[model samples]
Target: MEVKHERVKQCLEAMMDSGQLSVGERLPSEILMAKEFGVSRETFRAAVKMLEQEGRLLVKHGVGTFVIQPLPMIPSSLERLSSIGAMIRTAQLDQGESRIKFTKEGCSPEAASALGIKLGDPVVNMERVHTANGEPVAFSMNTIPQEIAGDAFDHDEFQGKLLQFFEKRLGRKIVTADSEICVPLHIDRHCQRLLLHPQTTVLMLKQVHYDEANRPVLFSRDYLRNDVFTFNIRRTT
Candidate 1:
């Protein structure tokens, strides 16, 4: 049996699956991996590089390689937005939090425009550091217009699901909304602190939630760890 790219990929996957690679854990060097797997150093290096490109791992020029813990999975995505709380819970993960602040304030221009409201309108401006398996994976900014958001001002409910609050608590089920996904230039400090890694790219999801009445209810911006989660766009003919 020869140790090749496939074998290296398998070994790495197994380590992650078994919790041996735990998020942020530095991987053994290529030389060590080659000797351990009975493969040439070049072969091991190539395998490591592939994983890095796939966003399952990271490599520092002079330092070493490290494993990146994946985000909560969605079932065969086809361009539908899923609730973060629901996604986290569905994975059977016990949700954990270290809250900084959850408050109500005036909306920013971007938020106001996204919701199609005036510049200084009252908005439910909320912030939270979302974690998965106790590792911070996203910084969430959720804003809703006070006129339409209606009683969304309740701070306690923000701890739960904002999407659900819009439907059940506020009285409307979302039909469709605009969602944009892209990688941002700078990762926020909160992300760096919570993720415990330096200068990783951030995946930005900017969404406007609309109701069955074709009215906008919520506007949200999520900065996710790019190395862990990816948004797939499904096109229909």
Candidate 2:
């Protein structure tokens, strides 16, 4: 039923992520694709439509369905909160390297506001680029109170899963996070270089992670390459 169609959708997404289906390439005929996936034509059509809505596929009236060049979308299901590293692993894609660009021990006004700290309070700021399959995908800046980060925060040894690292260090769990997504009109030169797409639109995510006690701990701003990632949200009444 619905489960079968969901599986079909996942398979199609995997195919795209693995480069089995390149951008601008035509998908097999509906009948053939349905047969290959062992799903009914109706179910297959439903999956295709889902992908189209996600900007992963383009449907033509008479020609055929074509793969869109945008980067593989990592589903951001509203039903549950998950880390970007977890999402990448779930997609069966390499979590890749996290390049630590810089680390500073001071708070900006914006960081202070987000973390609920007073101005001039000590904070640790980290700028990093997350890659996938040797290609850059996200440029992120994370700010944490200096007391939380401590002196043990070594950029070289720190890799993926910042939440996990913070939780382990503070001996507390990140119970929840509030996030907002937006399209930015402009991206700075540094972010543009990291994304490797000078002219592409940037998708920005602003998030604040809360501890078990509902204390704001981490503030992050992530700039995602428009063509390298897509986010999906499922709304329910």
Candidate 3:
């Protein structure tokens, strides 16, 4: 049942992507669309409901459904695990030039607690900036135990994708993360990196990523420009 609804939802998204359905245009009747997709009305409706919750469709009680213009920001799903670079690519936005700097340092008290490492343990400190359409949208700092990241890790090959580097290069699978989200009253340090005004709103996500064996492998803090990024989560009772 879930698979059928997801398939229909993907078809609807493809229609919008191909320009067959334009913003402000009403979708076809549920019965008609269900027939076209060879699915039951319940399944089609479920898919439509999913899209509506995702802010893609406007559904009226008695009137027809209308396509909504997607918000002009990168959308990140809290329920899914993804790298910053992956999020930008999934949004179908043209990526601008980005930069990364790597430094070797002893673990901070905070990093040590999060990564379950002793203070003063060797770690790799990575600072990265992510840009979209020529504007900086996010700044991030990640700390990894030197043993996990390996002394011979190649910065040129990393390119700021920690998840990919862990799985592909290091042969370690990152399966989950524990994240805390917050809004800061002041983020002068992050603002300078994102090239935003001092007063601009920002969302910060502090996370500890765990490997398949439930061992913490990465500790990161990501500062996202509120104007350029939207984070969403789906909750069920």
> Model 1: per-residue lDDT, tens digit, 90-206?
556666773545566787999888888888888877777777787877787788777766664665654466667677878878868688876555455544544557655676778
Question: Model 1 misses residue 174 by how many Å?
Answer: 2.0
Q: Is candidate 1 or candidate 2 better by TM-score?
A: 2
lDDT for each residue of candidate 3 in 133-180, tens digit (9 for 90 to 100): 887888888899999888545546675467877888777799999999
Candidate 3, residue 196: the lDDT equals 64
For residues 150-173, write the lDDT of model 2, one tens digit per residue.
Answer: 775764556557777777765658
TM accuracy, model 1: 0.59
The full ranking of all candidates by lDDT, starting with the best, is 3, 2, 1
- Stretches off by above 4 angstroms in model 1 are 1-78, 89-94, 98-100, 187-195
Q: Report, for all candidates in order, the number of backbone clashes.
A: 0, 1, 0
Q: Per-candidate RMSD vs. true structure?
A: 15.7, 11.2, 7.1
Off by over 4 Å in 3: 1-75, 90-92, 185-187, 195-199
Say which prediction, candidate 1 or candidate 3, comes out ahead on TM-score: 3
Q: Which residue pairs collide in model 2, if any?
A: 71-227
Which ranking of candidates, highest TM-score first?
A: 3, 2, 1
